[model samples]
Target: MFSTILVPIDLAEPESSHRALDAAFHMAHEYNSDVHVMTVVPDFGMSIVGGYFPEGFEQKALDGTRQRLDEYLEGAVPDNVDVKGHVAHGSIYEEILRVAKEVGADVIVMASHRPAMRDYLIGPNAARVVRHATQSVLVVRD
Candidate 1:
């Protein structure tokens, strides 16, 4: 059983996040674990690229994500479980791993729209985590 699990939510795909969150919440309940929900922004990429975007771009993006997560959590997350939402700036997979480490997650719970050839190779964010993460992973398919 997992003591800590990380669930990465794509704000843009808020509607689809429920399935992932639900699965994570179920697992968390089974193990009495905490769920760490996160959304990754592309700001880290822009900063690394060393360029300024239009005014309010970053804030707008962050705000949008906050709205998405808030909207999704209205009736999703459980009261008995611990849930934390974070907004990070960087690659989704990398940020996911970083948060998993920071939260000391024993298992990483996530979702994938589909698996293609790319996934068979380097794979998606979930796949990458499965390959690199020292802990276990539970990937929900949609």
Candidate 2:
């Protein structure tokens, strides 16, 4: 039985995210596992985009995202499940895998949206995570 489950969500996509969270919650209940819910913030440190935002934008974004994650958990997470929220910066797929390893997740549960042309060329974060993750992954399709 799994001891820890990770669910990575995109806050912009509520429907798919909730579906993935539900899957994680179900598994957590069955296995008595702790749930790690994470969302990645794009790294804006690159020279081009960095100039656009004013100073402290990264900290502000992180604070807002952390609040949103906490609010989401209050409503969505079950009372009995042990849940922790994490906010990471940089490439989504890489941060997810890094967090999964850091937290020692036994399985990763995440959603996959309908693929667009760009996904074929670059692949979606879900696909990349699936390919790179050492732990088991459950892709909940939307």
Candidate 3:
């Protein structure tokens, strides 16, 4: 049984994320748990990329992502579900794992795409999360 559930999605590509979110909600409902819907914005860690953007880009990005996440969940999650939205900036998998720990999530439900050679080389976020997560992770393929 889970107390807190973490559902991570890619806002840019939410093709199959809905499936994972639905599953998480179902589980949360069954267990009387709260769902934490989270998404990560890629950090402009490199100085070169940071220089290309204007000042306060990171804050702007976080704010924009927060708004988008709210809008996204408005239609995606049902009103009855006890849900919270979170935005993080950094590596996708790392942020997800961090949020899971931060929220004391007992389970993480996420979506994954079909593997390609490039994905195997660099590894996908879902794969990384599966490997690194301290709690249970259910990966639903897109």
Q: Write the per-residue lDDT of candidate 1 for residues 60-117, one digit (tens) a residue.
A: 8888878777766767776777788888877778878888899899988777778787
TM-score of predicted structure 1: 0.83
Q: What ranges in model 1 sit over 4 Å off? A: 44-52, 118-122
lDDT of each: 0.80, 0.92, 0.91
Tens-digit per-residue lDDT, 1-142, candidate 3: 8999999998887778799998998898899998999999988777798998899988998999999999999989888987899999898899999999999999999999889999989998899999999999999887
Poorest stretch of ten by lDDT in candidate 1: 43-52
* Window of ten residues with lowest summed lDDT in model 3: 10-19
| Candidate 3 colliding pairs, count | 0
Ranking, lDDT, top scorer first? 2, 3, 1
Report the C-alpha displacement of residue 87, candidate 2, in angstroms. Answer: 0.6
Candidate 2: the clashing residue pairs are none
Whose lDDT is higher: candidate 1's or candidate 3's? Answer: 3
TM-score to true structure, per model = 0.83, 0.95, 0.95
- Model 2 TM-score, 2 decimals: 0.95
**Candidate 1 whole-model C-alpha lDDT, 0 to 1:** 0.80
